[model samples]
Target: MSLNPSPLPDSDFTASGRRVLEVETRALQALHDRIGPDFAAACRLLLGCTGRVVCTGMGKSGHIATKIAATLASTGTPAFFLHPGEASHGDLGMVTDADVVLALSNSGESDEILTIVPALKRQGNPLVAMTGRPQSSLARLADVHLDVSVPAEACPLGLAPTSSTTASLALGDALAVALLEARGFTAEDFARSHPAGSLGRRLLLHIRDVMHTGEDVPVVAADVSTAAALLEMSRKRLGMTAVVDGDGKLCGVFTDGDLRRALDDEDTDLHATPISALMGRNPKTIGAEALAVEAAHLMEEHKISALVVVDDQRRVIGALNIHDLLRARVV
Candidate 1:
């Protein structure tokens, strides 16, 4: 029945991880220096692309190419991954004159990738290459060459793609982030792309989306007795009642805390006292268009659980408590 897990010893495994990280770190440092005019040119080409940025590679490079394409696509650049082997096998039709091809080959000599280069050129598609060798065939043929070379692989045998792959992936991120900023891709744009994510929900979920509206909103006329306001609060179960003017514009709020203070006044009668006299004036409020997180922050800052939602004309349109935000997963 025990659920606690035993700790594993870290001596040898930790050493290997440190070695791999150190190798990749050095590779990234070297890549930082190589980012010059060529990197900028690659960004410009991708930015100006009218069609998809088709990414192609072989073996390990294919995996990196897939990630790069995904990053580019998510960051506002239209792109996709195409296997070089498949390109010659009928996927070649995916390439078009309006598109740009971003080919990845650490050696610039992948037979599968090279086989499709001539056809791509014939189609008048621009080629952007990421390779370790500056004079690589792929590099020489590319309209823009991104040098993603590393001094050595994290692998002791120097045969496995390790540091090289890390450098390529990092360079891909640099291209994506640069393009995202250059295109003015905003948080709202990112939210649109990631609607199901928590960040997207936080940014896109407005107060109006989660607030209690219509009959669910707890409201009482300013002239109503404190007892009547309590009845409205109890009926709505929102912990507070919004006191409104004759025009249904919000004037103040009466909460359980306000009632506690009113109770301390021996001369006050809850049933006879006007709600306006006991209510807190200029209560914290939020517009229906505001983000839910803003309401959460306001609630935390003011030490209040509920917020009255208003329209452009400051008319009470809705109300919401912290629980509503929690239910909406905005908190």
Candidate 2:
């Protein structure tokens, strides 16, 4: 007998990988079709809940459950994760009568989770189970059962978790997003939860929060010489100065660039030429409460790098530059 070596190229290995991705993608699409009255009932149960949603699972499923719990918690739903192994120890104390338990298991036979079911029931907590087998032990005792079965594992040996875990994670995402939509949560609401993030600065940070106030604001009288405005701009290190009339209301803005154009005119005298002659009339202004992102947008639209925050009387209360927005992460 002659032994023949396999002749399949390396591309065949990648072909199998592509097949796996296609199968998993179809499994997620099927999950969308499988959503039914049970999904709606699950939402209703969680909607009226006065307590936290307790997410629990084992192995890879546990990782997905933890992320799901975090999404629910951050988006206005009170939730937390409980490792089944820890629950059998003293962690069961975290469960209460007001809490609802969400359990995840591929076989629905995880011993760690089974050991804590009795105690959970004794506390009057409702159980929501996610498993591939509807006839599984955990599913039998569950108040709501979400089916996340796949046709088969993507692994050629059919031993490792591939399609099933993907289905479970997708289902968890669907549930959390459903709750988010039902609550009518807004970007501002999300910004509150993520107050330390860039999104928060864009939505919650106002012009007053980052604008230079008091002595740092470059200010000069409208009648001040163009030469004097340059001195004020340099002293304040802002490259620009606000020109105010005798009544102390902002009338225009003068910058180093404007002074350059005036200096090119031989008739213009640096010491005698009025600041108003080189000032830009109708400068853009913003309110203190306006979002810093809005200020940035206004700056870009007007082709300027700074803004003057004014009150109802159009007096400069504060100032900000492009660098300030970048530092604040409002850009």
Q: How would you encode candidate 2's per-residue C-alpha lDDT over 62-120 as one tens digit per residue?
A: 99899989988888788999999988889999888999898999888888888899899
* TM-scores for every predicted model: 0.92, 0.90
Structure candidate 2, residue pairs in collision:
none
Clashing pairs in 1: none
Top candidate (TM-score): 1
Candidate 1 residue 76 Cα shift, in angstroms, is 0.8
lDDT of 1 by residue, 32-106 (tens): 998999999998899999999999899999999999999999889999999999889999998788899999999
Q: How accurate is candidate 1 locally (lDDT)?
A: 0.93
Error at 50, model 1, angstroms: 0.4
For each candidate, the alpha-carbon lDDT, in order, equals: 0.93, 0.88
Model 1's number of clashes is 0
Worst 10 residues of 2 by lDDT: 1-10
**Residue 258 error, candidate 2, Å:** 2.8
Off by over 4 Å in 1: 1-9, 260-268
